[model samples]
Target: MMLPSKTVLVFSLFLLLNGILPSTTVAAARTTIGFTYSAVPSNSPSPEHVVAALQSLNIPAVRLLNPSPTLIRAFSYSNISLLLTVPNHLVTSFADNRSSATLWLYNNVLPFHPRARISLISVGADVITAAGDSGSDPTTAIVTAMQNLHHALIDLGIRTVSVSTTFSFINVITTAFPPSSAEFQEPVNSLVIKPVLEFLEETNSSLLMNVYPYNVYKLHGEIPISFALFEEGPFNFRDDVVTGVRYHNLFDMMVDSVIAAMAVSGYENVPLILTETGWPSNDEHMNVEESKMYAERYLQGLISHLKSGLGTPLRKEGAAETYIYQLFDDENESNSRRNNSLISDGDTMQQHWGVMYNNLTMKYNIHFDNADQISTVLGLLVPSMYFLWLLYDFRLAGILLVLVYFHSRKSEGLDTKITFITCQIFTSRFISGLLIDIDDYFCAFGAAKTHVSRSAFLVSTMLIFSVA
Candidate 1:
């Protein structure tokens, strides 16, 4: 059954507009997706091999958990940005002494800086957990350490590497149920996060966080598993009663919780970076939730959602950069080092969080690039072009050109003249069709009232009849 021409035209216009508007209107900066590489000295692959793998995967950025000069040097000229981290154990020492920060930078950063593309320096990862393990409060020392590091970079004339510390979402956010009602936990909020945020704002650095939807789901069983997994369905949503904003996924809620907390702290404009986020493919106890399938689903969904350029509900720009947990599972490392700072919900089970094996092979089939953006462009463009071809019937134009060329070929020295005549003919047909189509469309709406002027209609009809 053939649809009405007007209906077909409206459908074509809908597809064209839907396809063109998304690509053009939403000009938000693309969120960069990267991986975290934590090296275990005994069993890890060579830095060169890792760099090669990252380049092959088209990974634009990487966060080094235990950054070595060798590993830093491997990324020199690789064109990949490095987010180098300082061990949590050294936070207090660096905070107490400025020389210590400078010396650390000399060993890790100075030799292969711009070449290595060292973008951000994470002063420490989850210092709260480390401080508790050490039986003291070194959380405040984190800001001091960051300040010292920033000064050290300045002293060395290195201003490109921004300084900040990483915080675990579970450790900081007081309430995760309603994101808008969330706020940073006590003492630390005032003593640590607020001060750190101020320093970050001053230096124009982003707040680093390790947010895991798995942890949130585990802690709060009432929340559906699909929400944490980034599954989209009509019922897969939660309403924030206070703010009246609906949340589709748990990750966005967790992120917006942080954003809301920051707004409360008076540094809402500061950028955010996810230093660690991923699901474990396996657990020591063989738990149902911790499997390869769930892991793949979570990572794939997270990547696609971020690449959509639709940031979290609170922050339109979303995370500036998000690094997937670990590249290779470090089986050789002790359980303490493995789950060092990511302890959440009183569950510190040794989990396999690596996307790749120690043999440097990926466990899951994943595309690290934003191929979805390319697919979106092609998806919209192909249909739009098809609709355009249908609307204009360019097949006739092609046939006309062929006939004109063949007929003119018989007459010597009429090539240019025939080409000009063919263009004129095509232009007249296009204009006549356009004007008549407009008149017909409006006539359909007005029941025989023509929108195009009568004189213009006469001219177009005369040209069409003459051509025929």
Candidate 2:
């Protein structure tokens, strides 16, 4: 007995759909890449222009260092998630008074929340760096502020936005070379990070850290420039002697270092978000490493690696969210002596870490939403191809459908079912073609060559049975 052709077609279609749908959806749940926007006085683009630019580039999220009411309102109905930051200057005030946090939210969040899609509230940006200026315990201020903000949100009956603070890797992590041996820097780890980690774990929030491969490369001259720029090669890798894990890029090595530090702190499950990571296109000194070419390469490579769905060596799932350091170049900051160290090639250099210009034009050609675009095109294309085929002949239509199905499955690493279904399609086509030619052969040969038709029929029967 043989299976019906309709049943075979249905079964093949079922398997084909099951195989292709999951691969297409993998990009949806992968790490989200966004941009960090800090408005510079008298130099920043308008909120409408900024929002329009982000939407034009298909960027899905943004971290606003200066979340003014007007700027926050611009993101309304944009479908771009906003990560709002409370300046370091306000941390102490927010911590000392819960009403301050509530008042801040009412001004910044209450009006445009669900419309703007506000996602996370970072209490402070690198609070440790500003500890000396504030004359207060940085750790205490961060944790208390976060608690006040969390409570404030609850009081407002809003639960969607999470609270956390950001830290710079170079300022906090003690070691990063052999990522497995990495740990948070001493007093801050004990005094500040531990309690912060505990709060994050209890609330199910993420720890935000600024991971800069360029800084790490500058600090350690032994690291090759290619490794920092995300260029893949056999020599670009660094092995963690303790964990026996091979890191192909500096970004992953730095991220895994944070993961190792978190694990040592007994809060391994808390999610990690990279609040800042980017290469500068140019600097005041015009350093060789800070060229637009290198910047473009770094941005493109980083996006590709994250979208590839290959997480860090330690944590299979990479940073839950990552924001490129900035959206527009700050001409003023390029001249400032911020974080210019003796190790930075013996010169005070601050790179312009913006992907775009103040004029709202892109500085680097990087595709932020390529995966989504490809998925969209294929979603429409597959159906359109079938519709066109339906207007043609069914035999040719079946062949085209099978070819498309095979190609899609092949991209996902084809398995036995795909190969079998492909063979079934061709075999069914072969049998149909043979049956159509049998009448011509019978008329030309007459009753004397009836065995010729019989043999062909038997062969077609065997092929159909084999497919079944």
For candidate 2, write residues 275-308 as lDDT tens digits: 8888876552558887888889899889988876
User: For model 2, which pairs clash?
Assistant: none
Off by over 4 Å in 2: 1-29, 133-135, 283-285, 334-350, 369-468
- RMSD after Cα superposition, model 2: 13.9
Q: Judged by TM-score, which candidate is best?
A: 1
lDDT of each: 0.78, 0.77
Q: Per-residue lDDT tens digits of candidate 1, residues 1-468? A: 222443343335334433432211113446889999977747778899999988988899999988999889999999999999999888889989999999999999999988999999998878886677679987668888999999999999998999999888878889887999999999888888899999999999999988888877877778878889999876789999989989999999989999999999999999999988998765535578888888989998898888877898898989999999879876654443334333443333456778987677889876656556665675566546444643644566566568766767676653554455455556555454455444544442334545454466457545533543
